[model samples]
Target chain A: MNGKYWVPAVISVALMLGACGSTKERNPAGGTVPTQTSEPYTDRIAPAPAPVDGSYDAAAAAERALSTNIIYFDFDDSTIKPEYQGVIDAFASYLNANPTARVRLEGHADERGTREYNVGLGERRANAVQSALLAKGVSAQQISVISYGEERPADPGHDEAAWAKNRRVQIIRQ
Target chain B: MKSIRYWTALLLLAAFPAAHAELEITVTGGAEAPLPIAIVPFSQVPDVQLDIAQVVENDLVRSGRFRALPRRDMLQRPNTPAQVDAATWRAQGIDNVVVGQVARSDTGYFARFFLIDSISGQQIMGYDVPARSIDQMRYVAHQIADLIYEKLLGQPGYFNTKIAYVSATGLSHQRTFQLIVADSDGENPRVVATSREPLMSPAWSPDRKQLAYVGYERGRSAVYLHTLATGEVKRLVSERGINGSPVFSPDGRYLALTLSFENNPDIYIIDLRSGTRRRLTDHYGIDTEPAWSPDGTKIAFTSDRGGQPQIYEIGIEGGDPRRLTFQGRQNLRPSYSPDGRSLVLVNLEGGRYRIGLLDLATGDMRLLSDGPLDESPSFAPGGAVVIYATQGARGAELATVSVDGRVRQSLRQASGDVREPAWSPLIR
Candidate 1:
């Protein structure tokens, strides 16, 4: 086009561009345009299944069910408490009944020690739990232990109450 | 006035920085307690913008040998060593005075500091270190403290050194892994590298020019050496399986690393100058955590080759390895003491993973640190203290403990969990 006509042609092209946008272009709201890089994610939240009305009559009849997962130790110590032997026994019975079950003993520590020391400490805590379980007729093959080593705390607040709860080995069933 | 001479001596003592520095000093081998010191204030810098003097005071106090003067108790702050009226400070019982001035520099500022004896006004130590920016001002302050600590204590200060650590924020599923470098106090944390996958194991080059670390990039693991002075990075090993735990030998000639090219992890030494590699271990079990001895002749590593993880020492040249740890059921991450006489290992004893110093001389091991889950003990170059990773709630973090088990302190920063603190070798 001639220089004088070029201006009008440019204006027409600009008008056309203003009217249409590429599919890859996005809105100003930070919402992504549909693109190959974008993966579709589900937005619908589903309710969990309704609970059955049946009761465990035999298990509910048992007196004072003990939580056998956690066991505490003294500072810098991995020795299992004598008073907690009954809980270990109950856990041992449950583990024996469920033969295919695998368990992970997680060890944790209070903030009193160094992190590496705690890793070792956590490992020892888990090791002690594993040994106790093995001593109670549980197969080593059925048990797997990982010392989170204070990496994962059961209670996270920085206080004695939190520490007391953290310094324990937890038996997790998998 | 009763006696101007008496008043003058008292006034001289009061004005001196050494007045607070006179507390009991514990020599490493001695049974004496650390000297109590009063680090009476250096004049506060209004625009200088950092608690510079306070940091010096804290370093001296934290060493366990110099008990620092509590800030609340200073009767008067004499501006300079010359103006220090020793008599008043002697009356208050502070033994030393530290004085400094921070002046603006081209980029940031220059800080000049001096330690002076309260009675004589004689300077014990003085230094002028440039802080390139406000970010480095804090580090420069620590450098000055190191000068003071070394002048007074004869031992090298760990303050000027940088600690390499792995910092992770966010939950486990959405976590970010970053290899970070910061002051030994964990200040001014900056990321060296970041990744969605785990970044583990950091080691310092003996020259302090570069840092070697494990990087998990693009579903592959490799060891990388990053130049701090030049911002250059090089990948040393990116083979199949695990390529991690790179440690530089004392002479800076070779790097001992753990690689799994053959479907198993074993210790391997690479000539940094030639890029040639030689395998150090040939066992079926795991052989990891290789730490070079101070003399660079032998490497101390953790191997389950003995049926359980134990500290073992093998010559750099191929030979039969000798196991160093026999007491612990499992011991990993064995770090050699700089003196070449001791190895600090993660000792699993009564169920706690405490830092244990194994005296190579006596073949005796004592669990030095208390609390739980302590692993990965790295020695301070002078073999005075240890810095290691321990479990904090939520994730792994770092804390330090002295060799004598007396001075234990955490790097009390609010940054997300930090782990694997490898102390850099002396830069100067």
Candidate 2:
């Protein structure tokens, strides 16, 4: 099937969502502007100043970023929040540096709306991460995505606190 | 049109024995003036195990259409039409009476019941149904109830139908998901398929012989078709992205499903015999949960094309979608009523998700459930009630409400999260 027939429409839609995403990024009064962009994400995962064995530990740096494997999302929104950019940068850098390493992005949503629609939302969230990694020059073959929708939730509670945690994309190393 | 199924070239797996899960039901509200009737306990041989009259009474009462006269109020229990005391029933304010008996036969057991119009003192109808074994007696009870329901209500009964749903047990990583099939009342639960990953979106085939569901394996998701009688499983589709929301066409010739194979979710139809597929919706926004019209010429699905999720209907040949719901802030999962007069859906109103019905002719919607979180509404075969999943005290459980927004019921399992309920069409 020529899925490209709808590319023009998809791009316009993506542009609209992108605009919304940036609008959501603006801080309201009294809200703290996240310091994610103030510091280089790599610096947080930089190698140790002086290793006991005098050897560089690349895995340690990657581990710092990979440790927070889950990227959370706003309610009913698949656009990646600025705060999760650090986690995405670490995974992207690691995947780009090691083309052989594979990862499966498991996307999830809160128990809201219908189940099947959440599956689509989950896929969109995973695809967002996939697009981020591709932008960092990671091989597409090293990444796969699956949407668990509302089936798998990080927190099984019904409140907003749980919903915030449930709306996430988990990066699982394979 | 209904397609006839031939059992040729099918695989049978005898190992999938049925496992039972107890479902507790609580009914509330009823018809304004329910038909007053009496269901006398069926005379039966020893060791029948189930009370046939009680099951029938429960079914009628659950419909909110009949108020069964309690046995304690009856002067006598009649085992046949000839034995029914019409004058006594009339005095009891019961216009109709049901009488039946079960007896052992050379092959197995036979149950017969008669419906007598107490006012006229005449037999209206009667049926003799055979049960090959004791275990089949419950099913026979449901069949008898269906017969009585249709005879009295002038429509097909869903009492004899089955309900397919996804049940999740355990917690967190230890969670186990099962695709279960149970009687309409949520009894006789059988695990059609089980997985450690996750199972969702279980849909019943038109003929009621198979179920299509989404299951995950090895961290990847796929759609599967499961043959109930045979326990044989077939992986229907597993595209690169989301492969889910599979629903059978009314004629069973094709399946309308949601696929994100092109990197975005959209509705697609797959030809079962040829394995060829054609895209139905090319929306950039999510277009999923496709439900077929009873005649199979149109499909109604949930979409976010207008910024908020709403139900949309499109022709099978692919065309501009028409939005069908605007009353709610959001609506998803569009399941059509059997008569095609209305669509039962999950409507989001006042920040709460509830089951709502949209009248196709009047273009009006009304809430059917009072909910903080209620979803996945499916209509019964006769379109009398809508079954949906709601968050209960323990976890998610199944519940039902009459189409008129009167009767309500909660079908809860002893343990586990039961959801994604799809009511089967009447098999016969």
Candidate 3:
């Protein structure tokens, strides 16, 4: 059993080292190094750390893991982009680790379509994120979704930049 | 994008009082040649509150049909038939002359007016309107305008009608919303509902006494019925998921709305008397924005079952829906005309949304608005013009255009975005 687990563990460590080295070169302007080294290193030798009561706040964990809270989409599309996968993965992991964690996904859309139809599009975007979390082993009870559509726009302008910013899903801890 | 902030600041300066923001109207397009008329200022007693003649003149001028002659150009200020000099008005090329007066009565103020045909010097019509209070003078002025409109233009007048819309303020997170009711001319605005959460989709009942709208009071969407007379609100529907896009049937017996409790947004109708809901569409894709036909036999809605949003019609008894639009890339938010012969909807073409009028009998669609983003197309009581929400320099504003696309007018609020305009039926 030890040998079977060691092979995959070694491969994961090698991948992490490669990722860490590339990130350092790409962002060499005094940016702090990615600080998620505790999990992989400890999982290889010791049992997983038990979740602490009252200390595991899903919101703080999310803030530390991701640089931004907004996940954007293409025009009239709700599919999650590959660039946002890491952010979502971090959130899903945090949710799975803490059984009491709960989140509300507020979805929105650009003001290009009709209001009612945009409401439907916004809901679809939020549900897309919810499905991703569910597939990552997060319980349905931990997630609730609401769509504001184009009603509450982050940037209230009539241009491409504003439209891009408005079409996003914001994850809020409950 | 920088211009938006500047425009917003300018609008904020003009916005105040929180409860009511009188909209300023700008007429962009109208008849090629407006019929010139003279609306002499009404002579009033000391106690009367409002400028009744000015209100009447503004209504006729905004209608895009009649042009009131400048008071400076008028040769005389006539308040009765005896003071009228028809030859002088005809010499100035005026077609009609309006004269009026407001005097005090035992109960309240009384107004008498007359419309004269300039060529014949004959009184075409006249009335003695009584006002119960000073505040009702504006409404009395609108009634006089409606009478003149119907007499000269040969069509039903919509001047005395009311409009319901949603007004929003504040930034993204700290937003406040209000459902407001105002006159068609953007006067006498009253806040019917206010919430920290989002409020949208205000639909008036047939009697014009109740409004059905979607509110997020419980952290999730639910439909609420608000009685205008009593200021009473009751939650009509609150399921697990979305409850939005509430529209009343013609007879006020049912409400068609969109519900997503089963994880799919579909059209559902609730019997107002029985409180029973019946699902209208079972499609996996979205089906929302239900509009009842004038006869209450069919319902028009927006659906994406065909891969893109388009208008579809389904019978009230429930059956297969027939697609009503195929030309636009996407079509939604359909509202039936008062005559039930056509529909006005938001059509997406070339990535820009505009209001389009689709005639059911001829299958011909006419683009009625020139704005890039126009939505919530609702027909006026007379079906001669459509009022819709459009994006302006300062944010969303209300605009109206004739069905022939000739006359256009924009209603601009001082602050916040005013949207989802629903024109009420002619008040009894």
Candidate 4:
């Protein structure tokens, strides 16, 4: 049993490292399935396309995505959905290239549960994103996390659409 | 520079009486057969603006125990027990009657009220409460209600109490949070503190002199102890991570709070006098929203260790935590009733978050509030009512429900969303 577990763990680690180094699997179509490793722990967010020329502005590319810089989650969950990997990839790569650039991950929850518990939930969401960014090799110094619980809402409506928008981690560039 | 400007503006706003947004309370539900009582419009000597008798009537009606007979229905306006005609009120099916008179003296004012049982034709209780000014008459009225409540029902009345809550306005970065303390009837709202950042979890000191609450400074959570009399705030705890849920122990010497610095969020108790701390729980799951039992020997808290958030009780000396709530999808924010036999908490069932009362001995849970979203349950001083936060038509607002789950009232403000209501202990 020990040998069986060890063989799969080693293979999974190898696949994760390969997925991190090779750029061919980048999800260009913007779908839920991330093109990187399927493993939840070491899944690398595929960064934005590599700059081709000297005039290419990585800051400009990140700015456009950061304009609507939001990553949403399911009800009462902190697992960064696969669809938000592209947004996280843009943030991680931009922060990695620009070490001086700092961002605050403001996590929020919908007004469903108790307030303090939502604060914990929000922190978990922010920490989840922070882990994702760190797994992609973004410097820890460039990222900070704060959870606003259900105090701040992207949409104040009581329906699921508003709650879905509110359960989010906002990447705020500072 | 922006932070400085915001602090300066907050100080200026706190220095004076900010917007007076009185809570408009509407009784939504009440007992099936309420005791019919008549509160005659009190006769005034100098004709004061504040109606002391009306205030008392509103207080009693809101409790759902008493149904105040309208002034129009009164056959006579009696100002004293001597003037009360028991036969007339008894004929009208009013079992009891409250009559009062407010007289202005050279010093200030004197309000005298009489609670008489029409069935017995005897005065139940009477009191002459002095008010320094007209502004204090409402408080005097609440005192009268409390006396009558205790005399009639044999339970301490919560009328002469206060509630501290967070009122938030604006959206996003422009949001302004004000910690407001108002009378139990939602009158005399005074802004205790203002913050550009979010403020939550207002806990009342046992003496009712100070409040310990969670406020964010520079986008990080910190707990502060604010002296109500001096308007001075002491930053009590600002650990590296998650310093929130500041609840005062029954004796007021310690504060049971949740700090995440060690790792994940866990319950801890801080010796307020010594400024020292001790860890209570070491769970990886979120362990927060701690409440001290009235005896201060045990603490009840919300923890998700059982795969979902539920109420758990543990000894103050750190022992095996016993799970207290087994019903609902989740139960959070456990607050012991003053009697310490039960806990009032936010119970989520069938996707609807409502206020729930849990019996400690039987482990039976009963849903209280009818809610799509109702949270933050705190028992009133007497444990007769539980004031919680619920989503109102305008936005979030403060509400109260009797422990029996009969009386329901919605306290709404003209503006801002109100949440996290902490009912204060009875003022001596």
Model 1 CA lDDT for position B175 = 69
Q: List candidate 1 stretches off by more than 4 Å.
A: A1-174, B1-32, B44-46, B104-109, B119-121, B132-135, B393-395, B412-415
Query: TM-scores for chain A, candidates in order?
Result: 0.61, 0.68, 0.64, 0.66
Which residues of candidate 4, in runs, are more than 4 Å off? A1-68, B1-13, B16-18, B104-107
Q: Count the backbone clashes (under 3 Å) in each candidate.
A: 55, 0, 0, 0
Q: What would the DockQ be for model 2?
A: 0.59
Model 1 TM-score relative to the real fold: 0.65
TM-score of 4: 0.86
lDDT tens digits, residue span B1-428, model 2 = 12223211212223555756767889999989989999999999997979999999998898888999988888999898889889999998998999999989888998999999999999989988999899989988899889888888897778988888888898898988878888888788887777777788999888999899887766667888887876667888978888899999998989999999896899999999999999999989999999999988899999999999999999999889999998979999999999999999999988899999999999999899988799999899988889999999988999999888899899888889899899998876
Model 1 residue B154 CA deviation (Å) reads 1.3
Q: B316-341 in candidate 4: lDDT tens per residue?
A: 99999999888889999999998999
Interface root-mean-square deviation of model 2 in angstroms is 0.8
State in Å the error of residue A166, model 4.
1.4
- Candidate 4 local distance difference test against the native: 0.86
What TM-score is obtained for chain B in each of the predicted models?
0.85, 0.95, 0.93, 0.94
Error of 3 at B260 (Å): 0.8
What is model 2's native contact fraction?
Answer: 0.93
